[model samples]
Target: MSDAAAYACDNVSTPVEAVQAVLARDDLTPAQKQEIAQGFSARGLEFDVSEQVCVDQG
Candidate 1:
């Protein structure tokens, strides 16, 4: 099985989880990451690591 496929099967239970798992892998190239991200987008899941999810309120 491909690394992406294996990662998706073993780690992802939701769209966010899928994106997080793919982004965390060092084994995949930029192209591979884009492909995985596109796959997730096609299924109505979108992820952008540049967007901040947590902010300091202080």
Candidate 2:
């Protein structure tokens, strides 16, 4: 999935929300999840549930 799509899936939600959404589905594999997480992290897009801000926001 594209970053925009991932963001869309995770829109207005937390990293946990994105992770959960990715986890709940069967389409992506564990490697895919890790890849997604890594991609987000590398781009500084991790989510904060409490703050409602992407890591890049700071």
Winning candidate number (lDDT): 1
Per-residue error (Å), model 1, residue 2? 38
**lDDT values for all models:** 0.66, 0.58
Q: Residue by residue across 1-58, what tens digits does model 2's lDDT show?
A: 9999888777645665666576556687656766766665634456222212347755
Off by over 4 Å in 2: 1-16, 42-58
Which stretches of candidate 1 lie above 4 Å from their native place? 1-13, 42-44, 48-58
**Candidate 1 structure quality by residue, lDDT tens digits, 3-58:** 99888776556757757877768787766776776666745357543322577899
Backbone collision count in every prediction? 0, 0
> Pairs clashing in candidate 1?
none
TM-score of 1: 0.46
RMSD of each: 9.4, 13.5
